[model samples]
Target: MPSEWDTHTSVTATGDGLFGAELDPGWVVGGGVNGGYLLGILGRAVAESVPAKPHPLSVSAYYLSASTPGPAQVSTRVLREGGSVATVAAELGQEGVTRITALATYGDLRAMHGDVATTAEEPALPPIEECVPGTMAPEEVRRIAPLMERFDIRFDPACVGWAMGAPSGNGLIQGWFRMADGHDVDPVGLLMVCDALPPVTFDLGLPGWAPTLELTVHVRAVPTPGWLKVSHRTRNVAGGMFEEDCEVWDSAGRLVAQSRQLAMQPRR
Candidate 1:
């Protein structure tokens, strides 16, 4: 049996470079569908269009409007297919309105082998058991954000203060995460998990829907099966917008994915 993530992110090719998909309401957060989940839909479309490229090396997406649970259309166009990679343009449309536009570079992870050097270290986190429940949103939060239940997220207790009306006044949030349904993480899933956490604004005492404007993800390595250590940090917030950077490290201590996103500041 396929995992829920696969079941929901699944897509069917229509014709003329178009694909049809369904947005699962369970993945809805705040007022619309989770951005990461939406990316999964788009990513799947591009992946299938270029079957030789089984993994996404990099993906950049611009969210034009909020997406809701319903039928969605994905239109894809292959831009370039080369010896090592393939580039594809894809978009998600709903209710006749285009909600997202993306460009993705796909390649085979198994075929990737090159020099890699990194000075960045994984975010410090206590054992998962010592962390707080990262899946349960408060009643007020639950009313608007039900997507948390789809994951097994154990947050570092220090950065989770906003859940109790108190924030750490910092821009860092760290946690361990995996699909609650036990779906193993993959390159496509990396696109989703990289943006799975609560907005960075929540750690700064700003509680509201922080809609993403743009998100770019680079998949590093195929993650070894285990809980993923995820961290999100923002050092800049201005002009009613903020930029957050995220890192996802596998249990083996390998950097599996890196992402940066620009989003609106929360307004209640």
Candidate 2:
């Protein structure tokens, strides 16, 4: 059986056909679930809960309340089912408070066209073996590097050159990463995970401590590449508020997803 961290450990079905899972503390931060991991767990939960075929392509989530530590309860409800798509709403809570809510949509097929926005061709995926190990704090690197157990990554010096170093006045990160499990997962889930990295980048900027306040992802497609490149940048920070944005690309150099986050920095 997958451990609590690998996947949801305990879940129950409701009379209304919704499903709920107890959230584990290993996944929570600031008394709320890590926004990125929550999206992953819930995205996978919804995918497992329903009979949809193509897998979740998009998800939009709202953070309503802070999730308390320890086992949290998750409830999923089917909002709509259509000929080619399905939609679900998920609520995660603890202590009688709804902490997080999400709406996920899945589709069977997407229109493919030759014409779309394109960017300067990014460099080829670098050899993971040749790239230097990331320089993030031991704990943070341990936390995120393990995530690569689920995704394949080839660090690009130009993009992710100094990821662990202090964030320059500009919060920017560039790199390549993809599902290490060797399968395309929900695009939204990809965005959710991708968005999580910037907070660490932002924190690195401070001489002390900083925590994330909000993260948002906008997925453009189900990434088809075995590898993806990222260009993440933070545009502003003022009065305890900071913002970062990430632009991700498929191996083919097509824009695949983008993410943005707002955070509060407190002196450590």
Where does the lowest 10-residue lDDT sum fall in candidate 1? 134-143
Across 110-175, the per-residue lDDT of candidate 1 in tens digits comes to 888888788899889999899998656677776677788789999999989998889998998899
lDDT of each: 0.92, 0.58
For 1-268, candidate 2 gives per-residue lDDT tens digits of 4433445434566545455666555544433456677666666667656655345666666777665446556677778887667788887666668766877776543543356766645545467666544433367554633433444455555444344553453455555565544554446456455654435344345533244555556566767746566665666768877766667777656677666666666564
Top model by lDDT, which number?
A: 1
Best TM-score goes to which candidate? 1
Runs with alpha carbons beyond 4 Å of true place in candidate 1: none
Q: RMSD in angstroms, all models?
A: 1.1, 4.6
The residue pairs that clash in candidate 2, if any, are 23-72, 31-67, 150-180, 151-179, 151-180, 152-179, 152-180, 159-174, 171-234, 209-268
Which TM-score value belongs to model 1?
A: 0.97
TM-score of each: 0.97, 0.69
Cα displacement (Å) at residue 161, model 1: 1.0
